[model samples]
Target: MDLLGGAALALGTVVVVVVGGGIVALVVVARRVRSGAIPRFGGTGIHELTRRAGTLLVRLDDRLRDADSELGYAIAQFGADAAKPWADALSGARAKVAEAYRLRHALDDAEPDSDRRQREWTLQIIALCEQAERQLDEQDDAFTRLRGREVSAEGTLRELRSRIEDARARAAASRELLSDAAARFAPAALAAVADHPAQADRLLDDAAVRADAAAAGIAPSGVSSVSGILAEAEQIVHRAGDLLESVERTVRDLEAASAALATRRRELAEDATQARAEVESAPDPDSGAAILDALRELEAITPLSPADPVRELDRLDEAASRLDLALAGSRNQKQRFAHALAAYEGTLVSARSQIAVVRDLVAGGRAGVSARTRLAEAERQLAIAEAETDPVEKLDAVRRAVTHARDADALARYDLGG
Candidate 1:
């Protein structure tokens, strides 16, 4: 009897364990449903719900299409002699029906992945179908009111249909114009605005996509939305044309500036050569040593190159200004060097103030890496200037320091817009 009792107790324990495991599994499934990882369709399975939704949408679309066709037939039989009020009512109803059908088809094709989204879409399609039915009922009422009147409802609908056809035609023409602009001018704009060709192409491509959407919205039956879309297409086409023209103008301006820069470069080279000769032939070689050093500094700067012509031109201009100062020292000798040194001392003071301001800007995150680098270089140059024994070399170093400090300040405040 004791052995029998032990077996019964072990069997009860196993049953309890199995029940606990089942409960845990059920809790996990409940959490998944709540989190939307698994669909909560009440008692209905996901596949069954989706099939029902699709069937409902298909039936709604077919009914809406049939209503639209009946209206179209009525309009064709009536001709332009229909009363204006009745025809307007009929056309509005027809448009609503067409929109409903379009919406239904779009939803059907969407094939929503989530159960929540699928349910939402299904509800929306049902609402649209109901709205379309109301519109058809209103159209019927309008026809009944106008029955036996001198103006037939059919005549007015025919006139309305013709107007819609004209609007569609206009929309088609606008679409064609946009397409032509994309084909003809987009590539040229890309080539002309080499610096920002991607931006140009993106704008054109976006406009093209909009145009295609507008074209698709243009139905055989009139839709008020088509009018707005056509207007948008026209505007997009005009914008593209303007963009191409602007790009062309910019290209021309750059070419002209390049030619002018070439001429200026040649002039600068000649002046530099003449200045070097004057310094070398000076009677007192010791007095002209600073001027000779300045010349060497100028020579150390890289020459103008095609890769960065604008920046190279700026460098050339700075060099030319320094060379002019050196040329003056070569002619006046010691007295001139003294005067230049005094001037450079003032410049050094100004530069130090500018560098301090730039440092603050850098700390505030308003300045860039280039600004910090230039500030460091300016400080180094200032130290070299102070340590120099010769007045001429001191003046040259001070001037270079001032230039670098001013450049750092400018860079700190440079506008990215340009």
Candidate 2:
């Protein structure tokens, strides 16, 4: 009897320990579910649950980041380290329940009457959400997992397929650009290879890799190029899709950047407005004249077009998306923003060149050469800038051209002949 009782007790102890562990795991997962944390198909329960310190949660968070912009969204997508559908449904339901709770709680503060009905309605939503949450539990062992990178992850994978098609157009464009660039350099490349076979071979491979990566990293909506270039570009494109880490990072940075831009813009606009108001209120012609003369001198020197300032502001607006995404998702946007700024700097350089041409022509008595001529020159420069494949090199060329134009015009106006 002593032996029998001892064996029974041991059996009971084992059962209790097993059951207790299962319960604890279930409870933690349940809390995660309630907090809008879905067990990512491949992500550890706690690992995927916490918000990434910087860019880890980009995949989950960037749902509505750029819902209304030009770079908006690619399309329906997927990923590797993604959870199953039921989990997503649960997460969505959890979000709705959270919203419902807030609405219901607010009901208690209401004056009365219909507020009760409102609270009751919210309760219904909570019930519905709970039901959906239960479905997540039911499907637990039935789901599959994938690698966690954006390309292979579940959610990102679906997204990848969708964006892949969209990327088709961009890929095509890149291919064309690469082809032209390759063709242009082919003679030089081949000749070098002929002269220094080993060196040429190495340079060609390096060139191919660099060009392809660049195209991939900055895959525009449409482009066309060669097969060799395409391969590199594809690899580069994948870089942006690296472990949804980039997405999360970009989203976070975009948030802060967007806020800063908004604050700065508001401050600048208000200051400018107030100063203008003061100037108008004074009603002094000489003061006005002084200001206008100052304005004229500045205009003659820089010709700050009404359109240019607006373009910069518009760029900020467009960039605000990157910001909203950072706030909502994840990304390393400073680098991207920096790249964009550099691209624009090149554009501004070209515009300054045209302004210089205008000044020079007027000064040198060549202003009568027809507006068509001036427009033609400006248009040609724009075409060249657009057609050039290497962003850095093309930008450099524009900067150089602009500098030359500016200097020549300045000389013509103040020193050369005038």
Candidate 3:
């Protein structure tokens, strides 16, 4: 077309046809909207989600503004995202929806004070539980030591009882010997009192009598020691008669005293045996070694792996507290020697058990020699403690000695030979 004129004519025809098609399309869209004949939002992916949510919120807001009573406000406050329309709507409404989502995300990201408080409370409760458990373990150890002390007290009481019984028996035997010495006058006194029962009773009851029978020639008289002299004569006569008695009677009393002595010795032996057994069965072990091992293991643990050392450290603290309690209560001269021996034996037992299962640590002979030296030192302390006089002071000294020995052991080099 001669350029511009041809182009203008073609553009006018195109513009008219475009205008007619746009009018028809607008009319069809209007009819569909009015009749509510459009497909549901979920039926197609064509709907603008933000616009729809805005329209729903606007309607929800309108309901809030036109409330007949307070019921509408309550409903709006507790409305669910599922119940509201999420179809096309205005720009401001869409922006509001976007802002609500942003607020929800921000709340999710922000650390709440409530959550931090809950965590703090949880930690505090856990700490309290641990403290209680440690206290319980301490009490258990204290109870065990108390029982040991009770056993030791019982042993001491038994020794005192044996001494008392021996003293009583010695006193009785001395009396019997005195009686034999006094009975010598039985023959002479009996003949003199043959017709008088009262006089005979007096002679037999001479210890309690205080009459002048000895001066009247009823018996041999001695003013300086009348009772003694009379008793001596009676004892002579009794001895004479005893000499004439059968050997079997003498043997019988002798056997009884010997048997009593033997029974006492046997009972003492049994009590000693029982005390040894009680200590040997469940011997107290050192808590330090176990704690060290647990610490080593804890050093190797990683995060989020469930091998947290918090609980382990708690157990170790509990063990340490228990040991402390046992040490506090049992710290005495009488038990210091026993405690040292127990500690040494515990070290040996632990070493042996560890050597059986683990290698390299003790296999190099370094740890073993140091461990042995420590055991020997402990034993020496035990002897020293036993020889001490003051119980509390002796225990304190022993504890210091043990601590020093442990420090030495930790730093010492191993030597297999002298």
Candidate 4:
């Protein structure tokens, strides 16, 4: 009996030891998990952080826009002196949001970052956006209080009425400009601003209705009661005014492009003459062929007929550039550099024009990720080229910009159904 009791005691001691060891292991594992040494199943990792950052970025951008509208309303009603602090806060917030966007764009680029680095960038974006939100919230609270103070409703109504009259006149001018553009250019070229006149009219109508509402509400409660309505009316009028102005600007750009087309044609003729001289002196096959091609392209352009000036300019610049490159071996170093410097200007212009077109499509959500990435790169290269002092390097940078711009354009058009 003594031997059996001793055996049972030993087995029970072993069981206790084993159970304690298991519990100890579990405790260490839990600690590791809590400390992030071992990731939890649904952890806040890079992917999660990226998604949250994107969402927060968009929300912060929208808030900033609204804050801008509020600032404008505050200034118009209470004057710039009263709105200075809010404006300062808004400026700071905009800076923060812009930095966040820059970081996000970097992460979205082709180069891949390690998981740890990605997490750091995403966290920074979230932090910047949150800071902006907090700053805007504080200003918004102060703005609300400011709105509650007494303001002159009668004067505000008078200002709004005058603005509405101005907007109406601008809208009329925009309609006429659109008619002129329609007669001169293809319908597709004016698609961006085609509805501006009608949209401005609609906004004006809404502003009128809100202005009338504010006028009615002003006499009953006070300026505080109608303050929001007045702000809405003012903002709508501003939007209408902006739309009308954009139409005028677009038309002006088209007219400037027409003038530029004529100027560029004359320049191309001069460049072709220079290229012919170079080819005749050196007798290079490629140079001679390039000059002929460039001259043919120049002859193909008709200034009198309806034309896409930007496209024509691009074609002429590209042809001239090819001729310059072909004759590069024939020209002296000084002449080559001079020609490169001039060619860089035309290429830079073409790059900027293409980038602007792609950026607009991206803003309209008609572009995909590929297009956006290329556009970002193109802008970066163009900036570098603009700051470059070395003629050869600047030319190289501008050519890269043109390449990326064309790629973005092609991708964007493809995404828009080819």
Candidate 5:
């Protein structure tokens, strides 16, 4: 054969083998599909899942129905309003269970073209089943809680009654205590209770009414009302006790303050007398005039009856302190004046000696006219210092004399070239 015929033959052989293999594969696939040996894409598995989910949903529905019946019975035994939430939960669960059943049926009947859609339906059914199961569990939990409340209802009522009775006893005791206190103390002292006695009595009465209402099985609100009323009663009793204590404390404080005022008044009188003596005995009575006037004013003060005596006492204390300060200042001023006088005398003597020295320098012609003028000025200052009566002015004159005299003596020596 030629090269082209050989190549054509090889190509035809390859084509035949490929076609034959394809036909065999098709046949095997067809057989498997017909015989149910091969699993359909998302078909068998999804169907099994749907069946299982449907079974679980049916079982859950049955349980929910039973639970609903029980809840209904409980409502009947108790009140319809009491178990309303539980009934609503059970109804919701039943509705979801029904939806789960419908989705499961759709999953089972879906066509091959709708395999993905059927899987989605299967998933939805599972979710609905789980949601329904959760709802059923909620119902169960609610029912359990309701039963527990029912079991404890009698005990709660008994406890409420006991609390109300205790509150009543306490209120009675408080009222008795208030009455006794009112009798023991003056009416004015118990003015707080007197002002609001009606309100306090009303609190107790309201508590009694609430307690009666609770005992009559009105509602839980009745119990809450009782608690509020009892709280008000307690507050009233506490206020009354506080008022009594305040009145008693006020009385005691007034007594103590009155006694202190009397003692302070006596002390103030004695302080005024002593301040007068100090003013008279002061070294410089003229300087103590302000203090004596203050003492007189303190002695003249008289507090009106029922007026605050502390103000009067404050005035007296201020006056006494002023007298003490004034006395001390007067003594200090006297001592200062004496010392100034001594210093001024010493300065005058020194000035005179310097003037004499300057005069001798001028007489010897060693000092010039300037020294004579300074010496004359020094003598004039020294005369002024001696003639001055005010100690402070005298000291000023003496200081001036000393300065002028020293200057004159220096000029005289400088003229002598010594």
Candidate 6:
């Protein structure tokens, strides 16, 4: 009986120690959570922070876009020098927003392993958002002060009417422009800007309706309401103007592409001659064939053909780049470097043109995720190319930018059913 009692007592003691240790661990975990050293997955603190951060991030991004449009108007109303302060404000806000996006992207790309790190990142995002909001608010306040809050409804209404009238005139011209472009280029080539004039007309009609409503005193809050309605109408008119401008820009781009094709044809002939000599010495059949293929492609393109000079330029550039890479294997480093240095500027120009076209298309609402992603990457690569010191690296970056830009254009066109 004595031995049995001793054994039972020892077992009880062991159970108590195990339960006590568990209790101590729970207390420590609870304290750490309260102190924010540990995150509560189910807790409202981090969740609410994340939600608020996301909302503010989106809001700030939208405000930045609106500010960009407003800046253009500001420049129109007040000269560029006078609009400098607003421009500076926009620049500052953009910087903050960019950093915030980087943080958000990092968070999304791969979350931190620790809950504490997650909370910290969330807090940082929230802080950045708040900072951007404050920056924009200050700029808005300055703008309000500049306008003196004394913009009479009559004055605003007149301005809106004048802008709408100007838009209508431009819209007429844009239709003519589109007609000319359509006659010259393929429907797919002009697809990005084909309906811009009609779309602008519809937007102008909506702005006119809003203007009429403002004149009828149908707004909610007297003068403020009238001002608000006029502001919205003005924005719509500006949007219409932007659409018309896009048509003009597209025509300009097409003309530029045609001119570039003429220049590239001459250059291609020169490149083929040089490539043939190099291959004869180095015996690179593949490189020689690439140049020949590019030449054939260019030769096939006559002025009378349904010429897509932009696409042709891309193909020719790609082929030339392939030959360059192939030849680089045989050349000394110094020769390759010298060649890259000379070619980088022209390559950069082509890449920029390609990126700009697709960027405008994406902004016009024809972008899918894949298109947007490629466009962003292209832009990123272009920046890198511009900043890079090594000629070879810069040229490579430009090539990558061009490739990504082309992919973005294809995807956007597919999305647009063009």
| Model 5 lDDT per residue over 51-165, tens place | 7667887788678656745765765545655555666666566655655555555445644536555555555566667777887687678767655654455455465556545
What's the count of clashing pairs in each model shown? Answer: 5, 49, 19, 0, 0, 0
The lDDT of each candidate is 0.52, 0.38, 0.35, 0.73, 0.56, 0.71
Candidate 6 residue lDDT tens string, 274-389 = 66667666656766665556555545555545666666666666666766766665567887777676566556656776787787788878579999999999999999999999
Q: What TM-score would each prediction reach against the true structure? A: 0.30, 0.19, 0.14, 0.58, 0.35, 0.59
Model 3: per-residue lDDT, tens digit, 1-418?
Answer: 3322443354456445545564453345335544555333333222243344335445544542332233223223222221122111111232333333332333346665353232322232222233333443443454355334333443333343343344334434544543443353223212211222232233334422322343333212211213323444345333322322212232232333234333433433443343334333323444334333433443343322222122222233233333434343324454554543433332222222222211222333456655655555655665565577664445544554444344433434233231
Per-residue C-alpha lDDT of model 4 across residues 265-344, encoded as one tens digit per residue: 77767777776676677666766776667666666756544666656667776676666667666778887777668767
- Candidate 1 local lDDT, residue 144: 59
lDDT of 1 by residue, 198-221 (tens): 343444555556555655544454
Taking the tens digit of each residue's C-alpha lDDT, what string does model 2 give over 71-106?
111112221122334334434434443443333344
Which residue runs does candidate 2 get wrong by more than 4 Å? 1-137, 140-169, 174-282, 302-418
lDDT ranking from best candidate downward: 4, 6, 5, 1, 2, 3
TM-score, structure 1 vs. true: 0.30
* Steric clash pairs (candidate 6): none
TM-score of 2: 0.19
Q: List the residue pairs that clash in candidate 1.
A: 78-154, 78-155, 79-155, 82-155, 82-156
Give candidate 3 misplaced runs (Cα > 4 Å): 1-380, 389-398, 414-418
Highest TM-score among the candidates is held by which one? 6
Give candidate 4 regions above 4 Å deviation.
1-145, 148-150, 283-304, 344-362, 365-368, 395-418
Model 5 regions lying over 4 Å from their true place: 1-52, 113-115, 172-418
lDDT of 6: 0.71
